[model samples]
Target: MSDALNVEGIIEFFEKNARHPLTPEEIARHLGVGRRDKKRLLAHLDELVERGILVQLKGRRYALPRKVNLVTGTISMHRDGYGFVSTGEPEGKDIFIPARFAREAMHGDQVLVRAERGIRSDKPEGRIVRVVQRAHQTLVGRFEQTRKFAYLVPSDPRLGQDIVIPRNARGKARSGQIVVARIDSFPSKNRNPEGTIIEVLGDPGDPEVEVLTIIHQHGLPHRFPGEVLAAAEEIPGEVLPEEFSGREDLRDLLTVTIDGETAKDFDDAVAVRDEGQGRIRLWVSIADVGHYVTEGGIIDREAYVRGTSVYFPGRCIPMLPEHLSNGICSLNPDVERLVMTAEMLFDAEGVRLESRFYPAVIRSRARLTYTQVRAMIELGDTEEISRQGEVYPALQVMKTLAERLQERRRLRGSLDFDLPEAEIVLDLQGNIEDIVRGERYFAHRLVEEFMLAANEAVAGFLSAREIPLLYRVHEPPSAEKLQQFQEFLSHFNLKLSLRQGQVAPRDLQQLLDQVAGRPEERMINQVMLRGMKQACYSPENVGHFGLAAHDYCHFTSPIRRYPDLVVHRILRGALGKKGLSEHEKQRLAQTLPEIGEQTSARERRAMEAERDIVALKKCQFMVQHQGESFAGIISGVQAFGLFVELKEFFLEGLLRVSSLGDDFYHFEEERHRLVGEHGRRVFQIGDEIQVRVEHVDVERRQIDFVLEGAPPAAAQGDVADDGDS
Candidate 1:
């Protein structure tokens, strides 16, 4: 009897239940013994069943069957009524929920599940008993209307289900426009769930429509509530004496803001000078937004949830109201602003010599744009220049320091891509007027390199002191990804083997220097970039492999990113009679993973939205000059076709497989190449191919093309009419 209850377990079958059956092998696993030890434990478990102390289900799987309380999990419903209860943990497999037992739970709803004794699989099965939490209170999508009802096709790919709207609940859904909807009736046995369209966005093709749709889809608030805006407006413009007294007076530090001419919200400024002995002193002054927005205050909570300011193509969705982001907290020239400053001394080698971060009040002496600085520094004493009287000398000194820093960084492992960046000039109606490539001059490089140095210096200082703070980390690529990349390089007879960890950043930079001015430079660098993971803020400081920095953080741009703001607050606390609570410190450690996830996700969304808009504009540009011949490179190849990007406009389009004549073409996945079956003709990615525009599908955002000087074995009728596709 004692042996029967030997195993530590939750279930204890009574003698009446044991009358059913048992197998020693089944009872071993059931009794919580290791599978490897099942043979010995199995003998004991079988004796328990023989002694009438345990029961076995069919298939000889032993269990002490009882009416146990159920555990709760999220119900992942399907288009059909049937669903499964999925636990939050990664290891837990989902429990099946049959239609009869799955009450009215919709997709993404947390629900109570009762484990029932029934036919079972590898894991337990359950029936949904009660609803707990609903994932989304509102949804954004394009609406489709009929005479009797309306439906919303969700904008988010993860949503997975269309929302049905009754005629009375349609509210204001237009046939083909985006709208936000609130779910009303959940799906039941006889009827589809109903929703009310709460908002109506504009047409799909418009750029504004795209940005707003994305913001709505993510449930990110684009505009502040009236009360919040009012609260922000009431904040006083003047700085208190108490605020100015505790800060370092960097007002006469010759600090200058170097940003784009169009930028109104200046968040960071740069100041650098030769400290002699082949050393340089660099200081990055970030606008102290945290001082104006206090902890647990209205603006602070809003910024915390928003986390970071989102910059759309033409506009920005400021985390704080404009009164602070663009006005009081902005680092305007000749105006005193609170700041969190990082000052570092570096030898000519660009390595920071023990840095210090402190709270300061600084006056930005000049607001210089990249255009003006580039012209003044490079083409000194020219038209539209030489207006600077007070700060011109200091700008020159700063420019020299930046050049030294750049030289040192290049000698190290920094991968200076210097890729062409596209910028759109929009008309008053928000239509694209011109697409310009932003130039990278010494002045721009100076600010960037200095800010990077300052950020790293501050991060290193905190780490050396063993302070827990958010750090920006970038690890080396996975071995699998690196191997594939190495294979890609072997095609050009270029071999790079990373020793153990990341290959030296300097080695990668040397490879870049070798490939510069070559035809394959763009393709090679782009692929190399794709192999590296994005850098993000976290409490765990795994050194950045790309920048080759041992420690890094976002101490600049407090106006844009929340972590920077947090750093600013910490600096304030260190200088004042205060420190963060243990709760806040613990909260920082706990929330790092979640913060990393959301920030990374949102950053991708922003990039995707930008890419989509640019591609659409490129397609539109192609539409205007459809018949014109252009030289392009084969950017991608698949079984169906080849994707070509034009050299003239940097636009991309697909050359359909049918355009390659009657030959059947198959894509070689391993080699990244496409081969023609009949003629044995081959086309590879990164090959230069000229193509003419054949068709454009604006609705699907796809462009079609036909190869130039190639015989059409199969005449192209439609974009998808590619043979062997």
Candidate 2:
């Protein structure tokens, strides 16, 4: 071997063969470095170790950092400056980074970390060694200007540092204005990131401006690109004659779309009929969005990027442009719309006898609202029945079939939260008019049951044929979370039937049933929901725990959800070729995983943006109601305070323990309550009391409440001291 030295080559070789450790002599020999270059090779190895790219083992062998339990993943920075590295591995162990060790890593920043060896704990600990990729290219924050410079204090506290802007880099943004800043330089270990204001959002106090800030922070695109919109505008208003050649003609079927009164995008419709042999034939026709938004097109790329529609109180940022989502792709009544239908045959007991999938052309007979359907089916209002006309009979049969399916689901241990959602009624100018609980009637459940059956059938069929499909999976909860839940339920004298250190959905369902209609039902349901894992899209069939289904997928809302559209395209391809070709199969295998990951992330981003909007609006609404007393329940408790949820507004506010005034409250973590030191007053979840809205901070989206008096009689307990106010 010739005498030579290549530091970069040596590092690349170790990284490529990361699993194999090599001694210095072995590395030198493998790289063809002779005795003359031994000193150079040794110096390079020591340098690599210093840079944390390689680790020296006990036997004088060197290995890549990961071979010594190091991991590389994205950081989830906490507001308190500490963070956790989410290593996308099977074991799912996130390494916790303490505040001092965070190393200026911002939230969502990709970094390489090495696990702290010899830490015997459930959670792994690690420190960031290298910044692999920066997640934050644009930052949204409040701008503060000085004589010669400006800085941005990030609205997201997790960013943890203010960005300094040079005097000339400060654009039109003024002090105290909310702005979007483009990063000019990333932070080093000693200095904060430097950025300049790219766009001014406006005053932080303005509700509209606050919402825009959230949208920008989440990187949610509110407007379609010119090319995507141009593509959407190209889609025909009606299905072409040639396009109907392979589709079954079902225009005469009495199908109806049941949705909310304000819904414009009707992605799914249902029709049901009795088959007379203890069977029912149900047709779930979903909008054939894939037919128009072809794969690899601009519209398809945009939809894939969006993943799903983002809906706020009075606005919608749709996945597809309005021209498609609200026009051709919508299953509007009295128009011939193309659809992918699931023809499902079920017995009287709700067991699926046969199922088939095919493309079809259908004209929706009617567009019905949930309230109207509820009036017809549940209340039997004569006006509603007369108005429905021919569709009334079909709705009757669908109600029967839906009930049977729901019962079947109940028997299979599906966990239904049945929690009420807050409906924010806003005026034309976007001020909150009223906040009320949205009623869920039989109308909603009927459509839900039908969609569930269709999704299950499609997923089951695709799995049986060994076809590639995106499944909605929710893994089982961890033992630690479940155990904590059991401890919380102990306060209410409730217990879950755990088997073999694990709980089934039926166990949660039983607990929910017991708490149904009770005062604590809402609190218990919320706790159980927090204990469950989040559902996400996956290429693997892991089954859905919340639905308690062996197979489940998003197959009914292609117009709004990208996964459903992907499913439509796959099913369409499957129908033609029986199965994917080897080349197509290989392409799909590589593509679907990335699609799953990106779509899941998009869904979460949309959810967070939606939550931020609602919270902002609630704070704005409460700004006018300060000092007013309202009945509330202690929805949450921490060492810092008790969180109160108002009965009228459906808004939550913190009742800081220090505000108690009379005594020092001791936080009882095990019981999820606070105990007063001098007076022995105990406040916990589900305790009803009167609270006056003390203050509202719209900028921070915070509401502060003070206890008005002792809780109601029903809330009184032995722990409550007589001196409690």
Candidate 2 residue-wise lDDT, 522-640, digit = tens: 77888889877889999988899999998999999998899999889888877884567767767877789989999999999999889888877888889999888999988877777
Using lDDT as the measure, which candidate wins?
Answer: 2
Task: Report lDDT (Cα) of residue 202, candidate 2.
Answer: 96
User: What TM-score, to 2 decimals, does candidate 1 have?
Assistant: 0.77
Give each model a TM-score: 0.77, 0.88
Which is the leading candidate under TM-score? 2
Q: Write the per-residue lDDT of candidate 1 for residues 1-725, one digit (tens) a residue.
A: 22443532313533334443456644443455566665556565565444323444467655442322455677766434567787644345577888777746666677767765458555667787556566678877788987776788876543546789778777655798888888887766566567888888878867777767767755567888787788889887755667897679888788889998789899998787777887878788888888788877887778777777776557887778899988888998887888888888887665667677788888888888988887788878555355877567777777777777778777768778847866667778777776666577887787888888888777776677666777888877766667777888787778787787447778878888888876567777888899877777777888888887888888888787777877766556544565656676677667667766666555555565556556556655566776667788887666678878777765667887767775667788656678978888888866887777777765345777887766533454444543211
**Residue 374, model 2, lDDT:** 92
Provide the RMSD of all predictions against the true structure, rounded to 1 decimal: 9.8, 6.0
User: Which regions of candidate 1 deviate over 4 angstroms?
Assistant: 1-137, 155-162, 185-194, 203-207, 240-242, 576-598, 619-629, 666-688, 708-725
Q: After superposition, how far is residue 165 of candidate 1 from its true place, in Å?
A: 2.3
